[model samples]
Target: MTRQALVPTTHERGITTLTLDSPANRNALSVSLVEELGRALERYGKDPSVRAVVLTHTGNTFCAGADLKAPAGPYAFVALLRQIAELPKPVLGRVDGHARAGGLGLLGVCDMAFATLSSDFAFSEVRIGVAPALISLPLLPRLDPRAASRYFLTGEVFAGTRAQEIGLLTEAAPDVDVALAPVLEALRRASPQGLAEAKRLLTAGMRDAFDRDAEDLVQRSAALFASAEAREGVTAHLERRDPAWLQ
Candidate 1:
């Protein structure tokens, strides 16, 4: 297979690993990266040899969120998140470190998520004067609305334990390899046809909800991007200072 900045590697055991390789920026999701990811996922979902897919990242952070330095313009990241959520095959998020904002959106899209004990998770878009748009559709159904409201409003960092408690993660392990083993094992034990059918059954009820939420998210996110607070917050972060809006 051809390689790109985002590395897509498949193991003989039918576990495809897609690593977000932009370590310098903590694997921040760029538009090109998301597009490549969408393509890779589409290919894997169609390949009969590929039984399951694992999404991960390199370095100390899983993903820091969208690459704020690169202008997303509009709906770019949101579309990518929807692609992940709608992928036909089983997708597992193997989170080793921190997953914030759009990064957390990736976790939500996964059919299952396994985070390391040391991993941190947060819906931190609020800190940047935006909402967690892409992930909220998946998250709202999994999490209590009250819990979602609290985290989305505060943008506070929470540990893996809290992530599991809030229904954001399947389980927390001591390390990445350990976290991935159970998911791989489960995939191995299930017939591919059965897995697909099961996934469809589970997701059928949420289809309408996801659709409505996606529409709402796009509208609100676009409005937030145009707000003065988003501009100030993003500028302050890029400049390595506190946001004046916070003060």
Candidate 2:
């Protein structure tokens, strides 16, 4: 069997769209997927013709978090997130599906995110006996504190409207494309230098958060993933049963 590219790139009118194409596992961040995405971003970041990049996905789920079967190293994942956050050009998000755990990290760091009203989101790490530590690098700075606390602790699912209200989405509408059109048009019109400088100004706080807490959070995340509780939770999830903690 031939393997398909995990992150596929398409260029249109100065905009580059990078699709997360591994639907079989709900586009989980596997080692290969992260590497491919990181490399693609690097290439696009240096391409003068590419004005901006759109991070999107294919499948009912945009991303279902990490691929436990072949998860990327925490440091590698953190580096990928940093790459996206610090990309000189604007990175937009277009989502029409569910995003959970680390998936929301992708959305959080995007300069702008647009999703269909039907799209859902969750901070599911707690239910899996882990924490949303690494993802907080981008998310904590952007998310509403009260909402973050509620969703992070409860692992509750929220729809796009609520996601927007909580500062996790730039806009959520009946049609994601409709919401994204104007933003895309603006990007297409702006000079690359203007876009890059504007993004730098906007993302300064997020970058600071990354520099300040990334290592400590990465260590915490690695420890949690290695713990017996996380093993039980992951095992129970794969087995389609409740973890011992739930019982």
lDDT of 1 by residue, 1-247 (tens): 8555675565758788888887878888777677778788888888888788898888988888878876454477766666666666788988888888878877887889998888998888888888887667677788877889899999988999889998899898788687678669879778889878888877764566666676777788889977999999898888988988765
**lDDT by residue (tens digit), candidate 2, 119-205:** 999999999899999998899888999999999999999999999999999999999988888888888899989888998999899
Off by over 4 Å in 2: none
- Looking at model 1, which ten-residue stretch has the lowest summed lDDT? 3-12
Candidate 2: global Cα-lDDT?
0.92
TM-score of 1: 0.92
Task: List the global CA lDDT of all models.
Answer: 0.80, 0.92
- After best superposition, candidate 1 residue 102: deviation in angstroms? 0.9
Candidate 1 ranges with C-alpha deviation above 4 Å: 1-4, 71-74
Candidate of highest TM-score? 2
